[model samples]
Target chain A: MIIGEQKPFEEIWEMVKGHKQLTVFGCNTCVAVCHQGGNKEAEIMASLLRMRATQEGLEIDIKNGGIERQCEHPFFESAKALLDQSEAVLSLACGIGVQFVAEKYMNTPVYPALNTTFLGDVKQDGFFTEKCQACGDCVLGVTGGVCPVSRCCKRLFNGPCGGSSNGKCEISKDIDCAWQLVVDRLQALGKMDDYEKLVPIKDWSKDRAGGPRSFKLEDF
Target chain B: MAIDAEKIEQPKSPEKVRDVPADWKANIIAFACHYCAFAAADLAGVMRLSYPSNVKVVRLPCTGKLDQIYLLRAFERGVDGVFAAG
Candidate 1:
């Protein structure tokens, strides 16, 4: 699920006031799962926006369009008819969805109503941390499942640096040393030999250098 | 040709009347996908399960197609809230 923050009501008011017609969009995928801009959120925002418009003495027309995901083309197409009537759109999806809407709806002005937050894992209620950098190359085997790229402050693949102290990283006393954690896990699993196998220098070109990449498989 | 001039400029205004209670009329709009939420609401109606009378639901083929502007417009037109499903 995508984590996002709602835009200030005052800021949203400014955008809708200038336009005679507007559309408020919602995505039910990531943002919805995170409880930001889903069907329920769409209704709430629309209700509040309308009230605010009335209070401001503005003759604005706002509509709501909740789709599965704004980033996907097939889903964005669902909004085509609504775009016909509106001069502007206030998207409640993540940054990508906002851009996708603008990219698809050429004549209609698209505005982001939510700030996209980081890509992280929800470890527990109300707590989360980054677990992967999406560096393109995955090397979890040697690290015994503990991702140094994510857990390590230095992203060191070799030995733990001088920062490794008391089984914690020098960056923070509370954070466990990534290498130490890796070693302990490997030892527990009797797989320390996996680390003994030397890994060659990482190819930076292989990591995101090729730009945003994807592979489409017609068949699974 | 259709009517022109003053005809196009005509206004629609109702005659003033005495104040009357409206039972706190609220205009709630629901942008429901035809697949799920709409069906559930339909079932709600079929069962005669009464909810807040203010809600007005509009069904769509899919929630994916709703333009964000429509939602904002509902509120602009004094709608209370909206809901969707896909």
Candidate 2:
């Protein structure tokens, strides 16, 4: 899922300070799964804002609201009434959700409350580790299900670098050498021969080098 | 991206856990590797050497197997401090 973390409260307050009416919008999807942006988080943020405004003698009308998913137009329709009543929206969603709201509501200023971190898997409750870079290529079959491109600090394809010591990366003791893991998995799976074959250079055009990407369905 | 006013409140301070009593002992988790730290701990016990009663020792195959998540979870679970011994 897309993982993100809430920006500091001070930064969020600065964005909505001038607006008389503001809505703390939450997206109950990917960001919610990461525990960063959700209904409960939106309410907490609204409460914090209210406390701050009251302490500073600022007259601000802040409302807490959430939608199932902010990236879809139909889902945003549920928030139309709340959005119409607000001068600005403080979106507690990932970057994509914030941009989608801004595009749909051109008149109202939309601000992001979270920094979109990465595409990752929740290893455990409140713990996430990155697993992909969206390089538009798949090599997991030969690599024994480990992603050297993303897991390897140096993105080395051929083999483990000389810097790997005691099966750990030179960058840090906490980091496992990605190539070492790949070779171990391959050996255990009886696919050691795959490691002997040198991997070819990746094509840059297939990745971000081509700029923003899109997909279309012929059936649609 | 820009601050409109200089009067914004500073970020809230981190929530403080309840303070321990004056006589409360510290809770420390020691991740001891089976090869060395665990053996040493065992030897210390055999020799009848006294150590802090509050220290909890966990034996692992190797200290390298210890993940950062384990340390974080320990703190979340109210462990005051932790150290990995290899």
Candidate 3:
């Protein structure tokens, strides 16, 4: 999932300040799973903004609404009335959603309420850890389902670097050495031979370094 | 007269207890790491040490795992204060 964290309320408040009509727009997909930019969050943000505006005696028309997904145009169609009425939109979706809304509604100013963090999985409730970097290359087949490109601090492909000590990275005691984990998994799977095999230097063009990446289907 | 007698004989349900009091002294949410803060809380219990009862602890693997949403949600739900203990 694409994990994100909401920007501080004060920072968000500053963005929409002085706007006569504002909508707290939320996305119910990726950001919602992280508990950051869902319908519930939109309601909370609306309440907070309303309470603050009342205390400061600010005259603002604030509305709260959410869509199934914000990156697609069809999902946004449902919110056309609210968007038309809004002078500005404070988007609680990820960076892409905010940009999509901004592009779709060129006249209205759109502001991001979340700092897009990382591609990660929910370890448990309220806990998420980054697991992928979308490097456009798959290496998990030989690495025993762990991507060294994302987990390793140095992105080592061959083996553990000199910085690994006692299954932990030298950089911090809290971080387990990614190479150590790879080796351990390989050993458990009786695939230590895979560790001995040398992996060639990765092609940089296959990664984000190449440019903006996309996949198009000719069948479509 | 019959309705009044029936009402008097009917069993009454117990009043529900509020998790948060209307006149609350404090409403605190404490995010405690299982390794340290949770252990400390356990020790306090074993020693019978007294502390504010209003502080509710939520356990996590590490304090680094704490998310800003959890803190915000606490305040949104009427919590007065929040503390993170590693």
Candidate 4:
């Protein structure tokens, strides 16, 4: 998912300090999954802003709204009424969503309420596990489900590094050796013999060396 | 009137329960995380802690699980606020 986190309140306040009217917009897609910005989250943030403004004796108008997907123009347009009333917008979406809002609402200054994090998946409950580094390589098939690109603190491509102690990575005891898990899984599946097949050096040229990558496919 | 009714004494007057009328009812909808926040609420209940009874809780696995459509949809249905306790 598009992993992200809420920006500190102090920073957000600084952005909208001079604005009399504000719109707090949340995203429903990636940011919502991680609980940074959703409808309820937006409301909580709005209430906090309300309380803070009240305490500060600041007459700031706060209107809360969120869209289905902030990256898409259609979803953000749904919040037009609330957005139109605001002098500035505080977006709780991912960087993409925030940018989209800024681009669409040219008149209103858009500020971000969350820091954009990389692609990640939920670990258990509160912990989010970072998976892909977005290195533009698809190597999970050869790694036995363990992603060395992300799981390895050092991002090792080959076998276990010298820093591996017991079954854990030396960088952090909480992190298990990704390669060890990969080897174990492969061994159990009688594919350990494939380890001898070394992979060729990755060509970064195809990755993002040309800047942002885009792909298009004609409709079937 | 019967003779038994004459023996009854007058009751004392009742006192007012409020100096000011109770405030308007607060409609609270909280989307709580199943991990920490939900456990905390359960603990509060078990400890007999008192809180405003106006809260309506909707438990979710994580704050991450919430979707934008769901949040907006609730307000479209007239929910006053959405809270993330976790």
Candidate 5:
């Protein structure tokens, strides 16, 4: 899921304090899982903003609202009234959701309440780790389900780099060497033979190198 | 019966704004766990022990059930400080 972190309160206040009527909108999907930008979080943010406004002697009217998914148009129907009445919107969604809201409400100023972090997985309760870079090409099948592109600091294709030491990356002891995980998984699965085969150079064009990309389903 | 939104009373603006008055007191919110802190508070009450009058105690099922939004809401409602006791 796309992970995001809320911006600092001071910075967020600086951005939206000028607006008299504001809406703190949240996306209850990926960001919600992280306990950052969900509707519950949006309520907290709105409350904080209200407190700050009271302290600053500002008479701002702020409301909190959210939807299941901000990136999709259908989910926004429920929030249409709240959003339409907003003079400015503080979007607590990923960058995509913020842009989507901004695009939909062209006249109203939309501000991002979160810093879009990365495509990651919930490693544990209240813990998340990056799992994919969305390089547009997947190589997980041959790599024992471990992604070398994102996990490996060097993105080495064939095997562990010389810097790999005791399953840890050379950069940090906290980071697990991606190749080491792949090798260990392969050994456990008795597929070590596949590791010996040489992998060709990855096509850079398939990734961000190709520039802004899009996908469409013809059947739809 | 239907209610009228226009009849809702508006909040009065703060007279001091950002300035703190000499008579101002810290309003603290304490989230006490049912099994631990709440029990301790109950014992303290039974023993006639005194705590700060400003510290309002909110009993929770467990400290683990305390959410961040609760603390934020406490502050938003103009509480000076808040803590969870488990």
Candidate 6:
């Protein structure tokens, strides 16, 4: 899932204080799972902004609302009324959602309340860890389901580096050695023979180096 | 006698702190859990112990029920200080 964190309240206030009418819009998908950009969080943000406005003697009309997903147009159908009336929108979605909203409303100003972090997995309640770099190449099949692109600090493909000690990466004790994990996984699956097969140099053209990527359904 | 809905007095919204005069006292809100804090406050009242009149106690099922939004809402509505007691 896409993980994001809300920007500082002071910074958010600085960006939105000038507006007379504002709406705090949230995306109730990926970012919501992290307790950052959700409808409930948007309401809290609106309340904080309102309190700040009141304290500063500013007369800004602020409202909060959200939809299931902000990246799609169909989900926005229900939010037309609130969004149409807004002078400026403080979006509590990821970068994609913010840009999508900006594109949909050409004339109105849209501001992001969150900083898009990474594609990650929820390690535990309230804890998220990055899992994928979206390198546009699948190595997990041969790597025993471990992602060297993301898990390995150096993105090593062949085997563990000299820094691997006691199954921990040299970069941090908390991080597991990606290759060690791969070897262990392969050993468990009786696929250690595949370890001898060396992987060639990666072709990163399929990644960000080739510029923006897109996919379409040819069947459609 | 049947109660008249129209005759009932509607509660007015709180005045903004910024709008208040210079000599105005702070308006503090206390969220009290019914299991302990609320009962303690009630006991205090029974004992005729004097407390700050500016403090308004709101009863909750539990202090765990308190949300961050509730605290911000208090400030948004011009409250000076707020505390949650379990």
Report the CAPRI category for model 3: incorrect
TM-score between candidate 5 chain A and the true chain A: 0.98
Highest-lDDT candidate: 6
Going through the candidates in order, what is chain B's TM-score?
A: 0.61, 0.77, 0.70, 0.67, 0.74, 0.71
Off by over 4 Å in 1: A8-11, A14-16, A165-176, A216-220, B1-86
Task: Show pairs that collide, candidate 5.
Answer: none
lDDT of 3 by residue, B35-75 (tens): 99989998999999977889889999999998665776677
Lowest summed lDDT across 10 adjacent residues in model 5 chain A is found at A4-13
True-contact fraction in model 2 equals 0.05
DockQ of 4: 0.02
Off by over 4 Å in 3: B1-86
Tens-place lDDT digits, model 6, residues B1-86: 24455335454334444566887898999999999999999999999997888999999999999999888878867788997899
Instruction: List model 5's recovered fraction of native interface contacts, to 2 decimals.
Output: 0.50
Q: What TM-score, over all chains together, does every model reach?
A: 0.63, 0.72, 0.72, 0.70, 0.83, 0.87
Kindly list the per-residue Cα lDDT of model 6 for residues A75-137, writing each as its tens digit: 999999999999999999999999999999999999999989899999999999988999999
Which order, best to worst by lDDT?
6, 5, 2, 3, 4, 1
How do the residues A1-220 of candidate 5 rate in per-residue lDDT, one tens digit apiece?
9989887777798999999999999899999999999999999899888987987889999999999999999999999999999999999999999999999999999999999989999999899999999998999999999999999998888998889999999999999999999999999999999899888999979899999889999999
Worst 10 residues of 1 chain A by lDDT: A125-134
> Per-residue lDDT for A51-154 in model 2, tens only?
67765778999888999888888897877889888799999989999999999888999999999989899999999988898888878989999998889999
Chain A of candidate 2 gets a TM-score of 0.96
Categorize the docking of model 6. Answer: acceptable
Q: Which tens-of-lDDT digit does each residue in A132-220 have in candidate 1?
A: 77777888978898888878998888868998998999878889999999999999999988878777787666567878768689997
Better of 2 and 6 by lDDT: 6
Which stretches of model 5 miss by more than 4 angstroms?
A: B1-65, B81-86
DockQ for all candidate structures vs. native: 0.06, 0.04, 0.02, 0.02, 0.23, 0.23
Question: Candidate 3: what is its chain A TM-score?
Answer: 0.96
In order, the first chain's TM-score in every candidate is 0.81, 0.96, 0.96, 0.92, 0.98, 0.98
User: Candidate 5 DockQ score?
Assistant: 0.23
